[model samples]
Target: MSETIPAGKGISAAQSKIENRLIETVVESFNKTEDPRLKVLMQSLTRHLHNFLREVRLTEDEWRTAIDFLTTAGHITDGKRQEFVLLSDVLGLSMQTIAMNNQAYKGATEATVFGPFFLENAPEIAIGGDIAGGAAGQPCWVEGTVTDSSASPVPGARIEVWEADEEGFYDVQYGDGRIAGRAHLFADENGKYAFWGLTPTPYPIPDDGPVGQLLESVGRSPVRASHLHFMVSADGLRSLVTHIFVAGDPQIEIGDSVFGVKDSLIKSFETQPAGTPTPDGRDLDGKAWARTRFDIVLAPALT
Candidate 1:
């Protein structure tokens, strides 16, 4: 038996034991996978996961706890909801990833989170119409323009919008009420869009999972700032996920539960007089609402 140890093999046994088994599994699965995109995804995921475990020196107990947390997250998820999405949102990972991927759109409308409450079947409404449909909260009018990188109007753009009610609850949250104030509108030939919706209020993220536990441990609140969510897409233009902040909402400039606020996304709600009839014959008493006009510029889609 050799008495002296090899210079770099002092922990050979431990190193072998500590080798990333997850990556090994991924590699085995990758060998069996045929889709090129799936292959790339698995490979990248394996690399990052292995690197993370190695960098953090993840312990068995910690790993087990993480697995348990993920399991609980899945248990809490349903067809209409995703606990993982809520986790990512509260941790700011969702917005950060979106920002990283959307960096190509310089000088265009800044992007934000799509959130977890978007609906594909929002009622279509005309420009300058009131989307709030008589819900409480501060009365607000939201208007905007949709344009391209060159400042040219993105005519016929479709803007999908949704937000919470005066009580800071969405239609899904109410569970029994009608889905009012949620709709999709097409930009006119000039790319201008406008609507009346209540000013978004700072609302708490769902607090019923391991992610919520993490937030509580950090002494962090789950309140997001006031803002309206928008999905803007147009012919020959890239789709954008974004929001307009309530200018007077204090949360706009402060820290958010999900870190979704952006300075460029903020706009002022100019006050208007009472008795403005929306295209649908809905009279908007401007005195009872805060009005804003915002414009979004989209990038041309690649391919």
Candidate 2:
């Protein structure tokens, strides 16, 4: 017998007996799980995890390192940052989960990963109000209407929006307790909504943590594509979480680090030279601005 188990060599009844017995022992321990779904999940997780360890011939040192990595991820998570979400994003698991949960239903807007920056109790704004709240970036005019799958306007739908500023940092990244570049507001009776927001820009996901180290070990970039986030919900409709990517962003062709981009979500951001009249006649003081329209269609909720 070699020092390491031979890759893919068939294990005999006696040879694998000990390891297989251990797997069965662990799986059987979950038999008392009261929830049927939980019991299946635990047993399946045990089987797959054991199979992976056997296939990869993982060492004690590697297992220890993985435990340490998760510990660090948990330690760094808080009100503002989520290292586990970053871990899941980089591993493509986040997008996979989103895809499974938000299936296609009529003309419903495509759903994407809910990045880690969302905060509850965001201050509400009125129609044509500024969601930017003074985050630094080129001003943009965003307008859209919320409609149901049947094409009827969903009056009073709630929309929450957030994004990183021009410097590639969200408001929560600052320790001074600043709030900007995010707000929630309701659609008007006509299902129309509009707000001022900073132009979305490409930025790297926070890279000073364990998730960053893992990405570095695998030679993967930590930068996310330029895009704006949106979470729209209305009574009796499936809530949608998605983003609109700038149509010409070079990163889209390269790749979104979180695998959150979709062709249907890409929209042109019309550039306006300095002195262009604002949508609501707000003064830009000679600074250039941009505008984009995103009409959202939502799917029906499961009863």
Candidate 3:
């Protein structure tokens, strides 16, 4: 599918006037919506959509092609794969929606796109346990503290962590049943948390469907910056779904296909030679490992 709408001379002024009248009628029809928020949403959506159609003088053939593309996207979607999320990510709508919803608080960790790979009910781990669970990669020791914007420890905060293995394939991507490179653990009494994980590597978004074809037509790469996913939450605190990107990953400068990177989210991973004492004393069997710290600060809930 073509990524850009073909440039047109735009609709004539007379056509635009008639289009505006239709937009008015559509907006008025939504005024009867019982929910005020729904009413505004429908009216605004109608206006913007009509405006877009008019602005481009959208051709019937192009519109039909778009419909066909979306139909194919819908047809390929399933429980394990979400084509719509991929569409939104490629269009930058996912990141834009996240930005619009996540308000900034003093020194709180910034949030980023929650990629569609997260699964509910991940296996639980103790405060200082391994989340790797048999995934393949260089061992990494991840440590962090969960705190509020005021710098007070938020004990018992639940942190969900997941990442792709060294080969850039999430466990879910394999046909065989396997649970690896993902787990959740709660903060200790002082808000400290630690776990063993694989060092995150750069990977391409699932670009095998309509979304991929569209990107190729438009000359965009589907690779995301190397990073690890995190979702943190505690009572009365705003939940955060974000990622900590590896510092000095060349992909960071190359760009993330989903536009999920932030300078604040980047951190260094200290390299440790083989046989270095593991933080939680789990032996790596003579393999080199890495360590990184992420001190997370969450904002208060919007009441």
Winner by TM-score: 2
Overall local distance difference test of candidate 2: 0.91
Candidate 2 pairs with clashing backbones: none
Q: At residue 12, give the lDDT of candidate 1.
A: 70
* Per-residue lDDT of model 2, residues 244-303, tens digit only: 999899999888999999999999899999999998999999999999999999999982
Q: What is the Cα-based lDDT of residue 217 in candidate 1?
A: 86
Best by lDDT: 2
Pairs of residues clashing in candidate 1: 139-289, 139-290, 269-291
Q: Rank by lDDT, descending? A: 2, 3, 1
TM-score-better candidate, 1 vs 3: 3
- Cα lDDT of candidate 1 equals 0.76
Off by over 4 Å in 3: 1-11
Error of 1 at 193 (Å): 1.8
Q: Which stretches of candidate 1 lie over 4 Å from their true place?
A: 1-13, 16-29, 104-106, 271-287
lDDT of 3 by residue, 1-303 (tens): 112223346546676566667777888888789999998888878877877886777799999999999999999888777889999988899889988889788888999998878888899999878888898899988998999988999999999999999988888888587888899999999999999898889999888899999999999999999999999999999999999999999999998999999999999999999988987788778999999999999999992
Per-residue error for 65 in candidate 2, Å, reads 0.8
